[model samples]
Target chain A: MVNREFTVENDPRILFGKRLAKIRKELGWTQEGLAIESGIARSYLSGIERGKRNIALINIYKLAQTLKIPVKELVDI
Target chain B: MVNREFTVENDPRILFGKRLAKIRKELGWTQEGLAIESGIARSYLSGIERGKRNIALINIYKLAQTLKIPVKELVDI
Candidate 1:
């Protein structure tokens, strides 16, 4: 199971990253697989999953599409 | 007019803060006034406006209530 310590209450980036990682794992996909599916750079997706990057809104939309999740699910609205 | 340079595409915290600041200005409220209305600390609200803090989701709801805006408006989805 993914760590639940990082939450939207603490840091949105971490919360997003963790949720992305969880969803990726649930789909049995690697970061590279997600990157390819989302049409984003592997390095950038890696950085995003690690909470090392500020993902753009467009990319977030792409990620939501690739992950088959709603954009609201990806963001903590 | 508030600066439109800071957007959900750049930084969510800044976007939220900017929106909050805009709404506060529209309501003719100072930071301290907003703090009193929102039941949050003036310093914390100031920090939030300056993008110096990561506000909690509960507090976001409080801010939304105080600002009379939708909670979704405070966050980028």
Candidate 2:
């Protein structure tokens, strides 16, 4: 079987996901709301928020744009 | 074919790669040198510097750490 335990608790992707979720909540936006605004699939956003998805830079930029924040804000801890 | 034209010239990944290459050059470091400093494979760094690969967040963090900059500095334009 292929190895399945790659991601650990301190993964940066997970931290980024949590930060996205926090910002979305701060703006009173739901996952669906932010997904539509950011032009990403809601399911995909959910995975990102859960730190299970390794999102691309474009999507990260889009999220920052939708949130009206700088790209560094989303990417940096 | 598996959608051969997936990447475009204006893709964010490509832009990110260019930025990484520029910073590395500003520091007068070779790709091999940056790769060793960032704890990433030289071949992989080459792909990222060329904007052909969608690098993971962990690797981005590692690059920022190696460069002695904030994660946002590496991610933001």
Best by DockQ: 2
Q: How many residue pairs in model 2 have overlapping backbones?
A: 0
- Candidate 2 per-residue lDDT, tens place, B1-77, comes to 12243356556677789889988899788898899887799999998987777777778888887888888888875
C-alpha lDDT of all candidate models, in order:
0.69, 0.80
Question: Across residues B1-77, which tens digit of lDDT does each residue of candidate 1 receive?
Answer: 24343455655456556777887898788899889988899988898887656565457656777877765555543
Which segments of candidate 1 are over 4 A away from where they belong?
A1-9, B1-77
Clashing pairs in 2: none
Off by over 4 Å in 2: A1-9, B1-10
TM-score of 1: 0.48
The TM-score obtained by model 2 is 0.78
- Scored on chain A only, each candidate's TM-score is 0.78, 0.85
lDDT of 2: 0.80
TM-score of predicted chain B, candidate 2 = 0.84
